[model samples]
Target: MTATTTTLRVGTRGSALALAQSGQVADWLSSTVGVPAELVRVRTEGDVDRGPLATIGGTGVFVTGVRARLLSGEVDVVVHSLKDLPTAAADGIALAAVPRREDPADVLCARDGLTLAELPDGARVGTGSPRRAAQLRAARPDLDVRAVRGNVDTRLGMVADGTLDAVVLAAAGLARIGREDAVTERFTEDVMLPAPGQGALAVECRLADRHTGPYASALARLDDPVSRAEVRAERSLLGALEAGCSAPVGARAHSDGVRLTLTGLVIAPDGRRQVRGEISGRAADAALLGRRLAQRLFDDGAAALLGDLPLRAAAAAGGG
Candidate 1:
C-alpha cells in the first residue's frame, strides 16, 4: 500500500506516561508507514478526578474520553495501556493492534535501593492497586500497606521524600517514561503476578475504518500475533471472572508458538486467604483455556471471595 499525504491524528491522554507511549506510536507510524502523524491530547475523567480510583471509578475512566473522540471521528487512532481497558467489548471500536509487550512484572521502588525482602519490619508500602496491595501484604504480613493515589512521578516522589518506604508500580510504565532508574526490584511472577494485559499496548480505531481507512494497513502492521494471543487468554480470564482491572486478581500467560500456559490467582484484600491455579493447552485454544482456568478458580471458591467486591460496570460508573 502506498503512503497517504494526509496526517493522522492520534488521540491520547495528557499524562506523562500516556504522552510517552503515544509519542512512540506516532513516531513508529510516521517512519514505518511514511505518513505524518500528530498527537492530540484528550483529557479524561481519571485525569481530572483527584479522588481514589475505586471511589471515582475503576477501569475505563481513562479510556472512555479518548474512545469517544475516536468514535466521533475526532482522531484516527488511540493508544491505551491494555491493562486499563475493560474486558467488555466496545461497540464501535476495534482493537486494531497489540504491539510487542514489555516486561509485565510489577516493580518495587523502595528507599535506599532496598528490595522487598530487605525492607525492615513494619516498612510502609504505597500502592493504589488492590492486586499489588494484596500481594505485598501476603508476602510480608508485617509491612504496612497503604493506599496511595497519583501519577508515577508523584508516587516515586513520596518514596524519595520519605513519605513512604516504598511503592509498587508496573515496570512498563516506568520504562515508557524513561524512569526505570526508580525501580529497586522487579518481582518475578512467583512473587508477584501482574494484572491481566499488563505491559501491552492497545491501538484502537473505529470499527468502520478497518478496511477503507488510509492508515488501516499501517496500523494493522503493528499487530503482534504472539502478544495478541497471550493477552487474549489473560483478558478472557478477567472477563469470565467479571472483575474490573483494579480487582484483587492477578493473571499471567505465555505462549511458545504451540503451547500456552496461564496462571491465575485471587487474593483476599486483607491477604489472609489466596487461591491459585495453572493450566496449559494448545495455543489455538487460548480463550478456552482462560475460561476453563477461571472456572477452576471459581470451583475452588473464587466466586465466594469476589462476590462482595464491586462489579466492573458499577465501579466504572462511579457507583462504588
Candidate 2:
C-alpha cells in the first residue's frame, strides 16, 4: 500500500502503559514517517484474568491476542513491551524495530518516601515478578515479600492503603505513564537485574511487509541500532536458557562503542542459591555473547537452580 492511501493501525493492549507507549509510536509514525497512524486497542487474556501469570501461561499471555490480530491483518503494526514477548519467534511475524529503550531498572515505591534500605525489617513488599521476588529476597531476607497483580496504580495503591509497605515496579513502566513521582528509590543493577528486553519496545509487522512497503519504511526509520543490539543480546540469553519471561531469571546487556557486554543471572526460587556470569564480544556477536554467558552461568551452578523448576513455574505468584 502506498503511504498516501494507507492509515496504519498500530495494535496494543488497552492498559494505561500500553496505550501511552502505543500512542508514542503512532505519533512517531505520523511525524517521522509521514504515515498517519491510529491506535487499535486489543484485549488480551493477561489483562482479563486476575490469576497468577505462571498458572495461566507466562511470557506470551499478554502478547498472544495482539499478535493474532497482527497475523490476521487487523492491524498493520503492533507495539509490545519487549519483556512480555516470548524469546521464541513467531512464524510470520518480524520484529521490525526496537526503539530507543527506557531505563530497565526496578524501582521501590514505598509508603513514606522510604528507600529500600530504610524499610523496616519484616516490612511487606509487593511485586509481580519471580525475578524481582527472588532478588529482593536475596537482598533483604528479613522483609516479608508478597506476590501482587494489577496495573501500576493498583499495585501502588496497595502501599497507599496499607496493604503493602512498598511495591517493586519497573522504572520503565512508571516513566512511560508519567508516574515516576511514585518511586521512592531506583534500584541499581547490583540490587536487582531487569528481565531480558525489559524497558524496550518491540515493533512488529507481518514478515511479508517487513522488507517492502510503507510499513517497512516506517519500521526501518523507527528502529534504533543500539537498542536493537542490547535487546538481542539479553533475549538471546533468555532463549538459550529456555526460560519463560516469568522465570526467576534476569539478564542485562550494555554496549561500549567497541564491544557488547552481557550479564546473566539465575536464582533459585527460594533465593538461597544463585549464579551469575558475564561475557563480552563485538556488538555484532550479541546473540553469541548471550549464549556464552548463559553457558557460563550454567556451569557455575545456575543449571541446578533452574532445572528443578517447570517451564513457566514462577516460584512467586505474580505478574509483570
Candidate 3:
C-alpha cells in the first residue's frame, strides 16, 4: 500500500520496552506527519531464545528477524534499540533517522537503595552484558558478577526476590518502561561506560523509501543531527574494532553541535586487562574520529585484551 493512502506500519519486537519505544515513534509519525501509524509486532530469534546472547549470535539476533519483515514489505518502518543493530549496514535498507537520544548511562538496581560503592564485599550482581560484567568486576573485584538473562522485569524480579543483590541495566531502557525509580545509582562513564548506541532508537525503512516516498520528509525531519553524530562516532569505533555488540567493548560519544569527543574501551572478559582511548574532532568527522580512537586503542594493546572474547578481531589499519 502507498504510504499516502494507508497507515504507516511500524514493525517492532513485541517486548514491552520495544513496544513502548516503537509506540512513541508511531505516535510521532501520526502527529507530526499527519499519517496514521500502526504497531506491527514481530517476534525475533533473540526473543525466542533463552540462551546467552553471545552464544546465539550476539547483536544481530534481535535485529535480523524484524529486519526481514521490513525487507519483505510487510512493514513500512522498524524501530530498534540502536545498540542491538550491527555496525554493518543492511542492503536495501536505510537508517532513515535516529531521533533524539535518551540518557545512555547504565544504572545499578540494587537492594536497599545502595549504590555501587555501597555494596558489601562479595555482593552478587547480575548482568547479561559482558561489557557491564567486565566493568563491574573492574570496579569492585571483590564482588561476584553473574550472567543472567531475561526481560527487564525478570531481571529486576531477581533483585526483588533476593536472588541477585543487584542488576545492571540501561538507564534508557528503564526510563522508557517507566521503571526509572528502580535505579539505585547511575554509573558514571569512569565506572561503567555504556554500550555504543545504547540509548538511541533506530528508525529504518527500505532504501527506496528514504528519498522518494510519503515517509521521506517525515524521516528527514525526525533525524536529530547531534544524536546521529554521537551514535555514528560510537558505532564507527565498534565497527573499526570489528567487535560484535556482545563483546566486552564500551564507547561513548558526545557532540555539541560543532565538535565531538569520543572515548573507546576494550576490556578483557575477566576484567583484568583493559585499554581506553579518547579523541576529539569536528562533529562532522564523527566516524573518522571513532576510527582514529579505535586505532589508538589498538596501539595501546586493546587487541591482547580481546583475544579471549567469543568474537575476536585482529588489529587492522584504523580509519581505512
Best candidate per lDDT, number? Answer: 3
Clashing pairs in 3: none
lDDT of 2 by residue, 178-296 (tens): 99999999998888999999999999999998998566876797898888999999988887777788888998999864689898899987777899888889999999899888888
Model 3, residue 260: what's the lDDT?
Answer: 96
Per-model TM-score, in order, reads 0.96, 0.95, 0.96
Order of models, best lDDT first: 3, 1, 2
What is every candidate's alpha-carbon RMSD to the true fold?
Answer: 1.8, 2.8, 2.8
* Each prediction's whole-model lDDT (CA): 0.89, 0.88, 0.90
Query: What is the TM-score (0 to 1) of candidate 3?
Result: 0.96
| Per-residue alpha-carbon lDDT of candidate 3 for residues 116-194, written as tens digits (9 for 90 to 100) | 9999999999999999999998999999999998889999999999999999999999999999999999999999999
Model 3, position 153: C-alpha lDDT score = 96
Off by over 4 Å in 1: 312-320
Q: Local error of candidate 3 at 232, Å? A: 0.4
In order of listing, the candidates' clash counts read: 0, 0, 0
